[model samples]
Target: MSQSLQAAAQRLERWIKEDAIPLWLERGIDTETGVNIERLDVTGAVDREADIRVRVQARQAFFFAQAYDRGWCPQGKDVAQKMLQFVQQHAAHPTAGGGYTHLMNPHYEVIDSKQDLYDHAFFLLANAWSYRAFGDAAALAEADRLIAHLDKKFGAANGGWLEGDYAYACRRQNPHMHLFEAFLALYDATGNAKYLARTAELFALFQTRFFDESNGLLFEFFNDDWTRLADARGSWVEPGHMMEWVWLLDWYSRRSGRPVQAYLDALYARGLAIGQAPSGLLYDVVAENGDVVDTGKRCWGITELIKASLVQIRSGHPQAEAIAIKAVDDLFTYYLSASTAGSYVDRRGADDEVIVDVAPASTLYHLIVVAVELLDHCEGRVQAR
Candidate 1:
C-alpha cells in the first residue's frame, strides 16, 4: 500500500479504538439489559423509551465484528456471538415468512413488524461480518436466508429490490442503495456469485430507473409499480444519498472490474452542486429541478457524504477526498461533541436540543465508519502528495 494509504488506515484505527468504541462501550452499552440504549443525550443519559431498532442492533454487531476481524477488541469473538444471539432472539419475528422488524421495545418485544429491505440489508451486513469474524457457517446461512427472502419478496421485476412497506407500497432509492452495501459486503466475505450478480443487477436499476442521467442526481421515492412519483417531496434530492451512490458505484465498479468513472464523476458533481449553508453542511433534500427543498441537516447525511468522498479518494479521486474533508470538518465542528466525562452526542435537533435517540446504534456506527474512512483517505492523500 502507498504511504498515504497506510497513514489513513492508521488514523482510522486510532479513532475507532480511542474515540468511537470507548464512548459506545461506556455510555451506550446497557450492562443490565444486554443491549444498548435507543437514544443517548449529550450528557450520556439513556432514554429507555426510545427503543432499539433491529438495524441498530445489527450495526452494533457489525462494529464489534469489525473490531474482532481487525484484532482491535480482544475476546471480541464472544461479544460478537452474544450480539448475534440478541438480534436473533429479540429482532427476528416469525410472521409473514418471518422477517425482521425495525423497532423493538426495551424488553425486546417487537412493536413494529413492517419489513424494509434497508433493514434486511443491515442484517445481511452484520451476518456477513460475523461470518468473517468467526467463520460461522450459521451466520453465513442466516445472511443467505435474508438475501433469499429479499430477492423473493422485495425484488422488483426490473432488477432492483423494492424499498419497503413504509409510506404504503411506495419505493425509494435509499433501500436499494443500502442493499448494494449488503451485497458488496456479502461478496467480499463469501465470494458469493449471487451477491455479485445482485450487485450488478441493482447497479443497472440505478443507472436506468432511478438516476437522472441529465441532471446527475438520483430521484428518491417511487410508487409500488416502480413508477416515479411526481410530488416535490417524492423527488427530493439528498446530497448525502448522492454521495452514497457515488461510493457504491465506485465500490461496485472495483468489485466487478467494471469502470463507471463517468457515473461516479457525475454524482460527485451533482452532490457538490447542491451545497449547504450556516455550516457548509449538506442539506437533507432538494427539488427535482435541483432546487433546495428540505433544509434539515441530519447526522446520517453527513456520514454518507464522508463515506462517498472517502471511497473516491481511496480509489484515486482526490477531488472526492477534498469534498469529503470539507463536509466532515463542517459536521465535526458544528455537530459532533465529546464530553469531558466520556459522554458523546453526535446529533442536535432543529431546536438545538440534543436529539437523544436511544437506539442510535446504526447512526453512530456509520458515523464511526465514515470517520475512519475519511481519515484513511486523508492519510493516503497526504502520503501521495
Candidate 2:
C-alpha cells in the first residue's frame, strides 16, 4: 500500500473504534426500551419519539456484533444482546403466526404488523450475527424459525419471495438482495448447507430476474411474474445495489467455487458508468438508459463502493486499489463530520448540499463494514509490501 493509503486506513480505524462506535452506544440506544434509537441530530441528541423500524434494530445489532468481531468495541456483545432481546420482545407480531412486525412506537407497542420481506431478512441477519458473536443458541433457532416463516408466508411461485402483502403490480429486488445477504451470513455462522443452497438459488434469480443483460444494469422492480417492468420503475437502477451485488458475488465465488467473473465485470462497469457522479460519490438512482433519476448521494452507497473496490483489489483488478483509495478519501472529506467527531451527513443533494441534517443510526452498519474491510486490506498490503 502507498504510505498515504496506509495512513488513511489508520485514521478510519481510529474514527470507528474511538469515535463512531462509542458515540452510537452512548447516544443511539434507548435505555428505557433497550432498543436502538432511530436517529441522532447533528448535535448528537437522540430522536426519542421516532417510530423504530425493525430493520434498524436488526442493523444496529449486526453493527455491534461486527464491531465486537473486529475487536473495535469491547462492549459490543453486551449491546448486541440487549438489542436482540428487545427485538425479540417487541418486534415480533403479537397475534400473527411468526414473522417480525414492521414498526414499533417509542413505548414498544407494535404500530405496524405488516409482514415485510425486508424486515424478515434483517431479522435473520441479526440472529446470525448475534449467534456468531455470543454463541446464542436461541438466536440460531430464531433464525431458522424466521426462515421457515418467510418461506411459508411470502414464498413466490417464480422462485424468489414476494415483497410483502402490499405488493403492487411490481415486486422489488431489494428484499431478495438482503435475503441473499442474510442467508450467506447464516451459512457462515452455522455451516449449514441449506443456507448455502438457498443463497445459490437467489443468485440464480439475480441472473434470471434481476440482472438486465441488455444494458448490464440491475433492474429495481419486476412484474408479478418476475419480468422487468416496462415503465419507469422497471428502468430504475441503483448503483449502490450493483456495487453491493458485486461484493456479494465475489464472496460467493470465493466460498462456493462459483464462476462469477462475468457478472462481477458487468456490474462493476455498469456501476461506475451510471452511478458515479463527478464528485466521485455514487448517485442514488439512475435509469437503465443511464440518466440520473435521483441526483442524491448517500453514505451507504459510498460504503458499498468501498467494499466492492476492496474485493476487486484483492482479486488483483488493476484499477481497484486506486479506486478504493479515492473512495476512502471521499468518505473522509464529505461524509465524515469535522465537528461532530463520529456522526456523518447521511445524504447530500446533487448540488452537494446536505439533504439530511440528522445522522441515522442505520448508517453505522455501513461505516463499520467499510472500516473493517479497509483495516484488513491495509494490513495485507503492508505485509505484501
Candidate 3:
C-alpha cells in the first residue's frame, strides 16, 4: 500500500475500534427499548424522548456486516448478531400489504404500519450483510423474504421496481440504488441468480428512469409511470449518491467484465463538476439543471467522493490524481481535523462556518470508506508510477 493510503486505513481501523465499537456497545444498546437508539447527543447521552427509526437498527446490522471485509474487529460481528435479534423481536411489524413498517416508537412499538420501499431496502441490505458475516440462515431467509416482497409489491409491469406505498405508489432511485447494493451483497454471498436478476432490473431502472443521457448525471426522482417529476421532486442531486453509484457500478463492471469504462468516466466527470464547493468540500445535492441544492457540508458526501475518486483512479484513470488531492485536503480541513471521538460535525454552509450537528456512526462509516478506497488507490497509483 502507498504511504498515504496506509495512513488512511490505519486511521479508519483505529476510529472503528476506539470510537464505533465501544460507543455502541455501551450507549446504543438501548436496553429499555431492546433496539438501537438513533441519536446520541454530543454529551454522549441518548435522546430518551426521540422516536426510533427502524432503519437505524438495520444500519447497525450493516456496520457489523462490514467487519469481515475490513478485518479490524471481531466484536462488530457479535454486536451485529445481537442487533439482528433485537430487530426480529421488537421492530418488525406485519402490514396489510404483507410488508414491514418504517416507523417505530421509542419503546420499539410500531408507530406507522405503512410499508415503504426505503425501509424495506435498508432491511434487505442489513439482512444480506448479516447473513454474510455470521452464516446465519435466518438472516438469509429474512433477506430473501424482503426480496420476494420487493418483487411482489414493487415490481412494475414493464420490469422495474416501484417505490411502495405510505400514501401512494411512486418510483424513486433511492430504493432501487439500495436494492442493487443489497443484491450485490447477496450475489457475493450466495452466488444466487435471483439476487443478480434483481440487481439487473435495478440497473435498467437507473438507465431508463434515473440516468440523464443528455447531461451524464442521474435524475433525483421520478413518478410511478417513470415520468420525469422535473420539479424539486427530481431536482435534488446528492453527490454522495452519485459517488456511491459509481463505486457500485465499478464493482458490477469488474464482476461482470461488461466494459463499463465509459459510464464510469462520465460519472466521475459529473461528480467532480457539480459536487466540489469553493472550500473543496462536496455538496449534498446539485439540482437536475446543475444548480447546488444543499450547501451544507456533510461528511457522507466527502467520503463517498473519495471512494469514487479512488475507484476511478485505481481502475486505471491517472487523471484523478489532482481530484483526489483536493478531496483529501478538503476532507482533512472540513471533517477529519474537527472530528472528536469518532463523531463528525455536519457543516451548515458551503464554507464550513457553522456546525449543525455531530453524528458518529455515519461519520465513522464514511471514514472507513474513504480510508479503504484511498488505500486501494494509493497502492494502484504507486505501482503505476
Candidate 4:
C-alpha cells in the first residue's frame, strides 16, 4: 500500500464514517413502520411510496450488521434486527415452501409473492452477518433453513440453482455469485463446514459454467443449459461482475487454498482494458470482444472496481495501489460526494449525466462494503476514519 492510498483512505473514511453513516441511520429507516427506506430523492428526502424490494431490505440489514461488527455504529445491531424483523414478519412467501417474497410495501404488505433466487441470496447474507454481529442463534438457524429451501425450490438437476421457484429460460451468474458470497459469509460467521462445502460447489459451478475460458471473461445471461445467451449484442459482460469475481475469487482462495491467480489476472486485465469509460468509470455492460454494449455507469460497479483493485493491491499487483487510490477518489467525486449527503446518484448516462437521482437502499450495501474493505486494508497505519 502506498502512503498516498493511506492518506486518501483516511479522507474517504471521514466521509463514510462521520458524514454518511449518521445521515443514513437518521433518514434511511422508517421510525414508525421500521421499513428500510427504498431510496432517497435527489433532495435527500426518503421515497415514502416506492415498494421495498426484499433484496434491499436484506442488504440494509447486512449493512447495519456489518456496521455494528466494525464498531462504526453503536446501535447498528438494533437497527439491523429491526430490519430483519420487518422482513421476516411481512416478506415471507405466501406458500407452503420456505424462503421470502420478492417485494413488499413500506407499510408491511407483501407486494410480490414470487420467490426469487437473488432476493433469497441477500436474505441469507443478512442473516449470516446478523448471526456474526450478535451471535444470534435464530439468525443462523434461519440461514440454514433458507439454504434447505433453496435446495428444494431452486436446485438444478444438472448443476447450479434455478432463477426462482419456476425455471426461467435465461439463467444469471449474478445471483449465483451472490449466493456464493452469502455461503462464504455464512461459513465465516459460523465456522460451519457445510457452508464452506456449499461454497466449493458454487466455485466449481463458476469454473464449469459461468466462466468463459476462451476469452477469460464471465458473461451475464446464459441459456437453460448454461450456454452463452447474449442477444444481438454478442456476449454481454459487466465490468463490475468481472471485478466482483476477482474479489470473490480472492475470498474463496483464502479459505479453500484454491489457485485462482489466472482467473483473477485475466478478469482484471480485460475489465480495465475494455470495461471503463474515459472518466475511469466501469460501464454497465460491454461486449465480449472489447465492444461497449452500454455506455451507462452505475454506483455499485464503481464500488466493486474499488474492491477488486484493493484485492489486487494486496496480491502485489504493480499498479494496483494507484488504481485503488484513483478509484476511491472517483467513487466520491462521481457518485458519493456529488449527490446529496446520505444519498447518491444511482446511474450516469453516456454523456456522464445523472440519469437516476435516487439512492436505492440496495446500493448502500456496496458503499458500506467498500468502506469496510478500505478500513481493513489501511488499519493501524492511520487513525480510524
Clashing pairs in 3: none
What are the per-residue Cα lDDT tens digits for candidate 1 across 257-292?
777878877887778777454465677777766676
**Model 2 residue 297 lDDT?**
93
Candidate 4: RMSD to truth = 2.7
**Tens-digit lDDT string for candidate 3 (25-83):** 68777655446777666556766677766677777767766755467566667677777
Worst 10-residue lDDT window for candidate 2 reads 376-385
Candidate 1 lDDT (Cα, 0 to 1): 0.70
In order, candidate lDDTs are 0.70, 0.85, 0.69, 0.85
Question: For every model shown, what is its TM-score relative to the native structure?
Answer: 0.87, 0.96, 0.89, 0.96
Candidate 1: regions farther than 4 A off: 1-13, 165-169, 314-319, 338-359, 375-385
- TM-score of candidate 2 on Cα atoms, chains taken together: 0.96
Candidate 4: misplaced stretches above 4 Å? 380-385
- lDDT measured at residue 29 in model 2 versus the true structure, 0 to 100: 80
Find the 10 residues in a row with the least total lDDT in model 4.
Answer: 376-385
- lDDT ranking of the models: 4, 2, 1, 3
Q: RMSD in angstroms, all models?
A: 3.6, 2.3, 3.1, 2.7
Q: Across residues 1-385, which tens digit of lDDT does each residue of candidate 2 receive?
A: 6776677778889999889888887888877777888888877787776887878888999999988988878888888888878777767777668977888787778888888888888889889998888899999999999888888878888888888766456788999998998998898898889999999999999989899777788889988898878888888999999999998887777668888888888898899998999989999999988899999999899889988887777667898888888888889888896367788888889887889878888888788877877887778731221
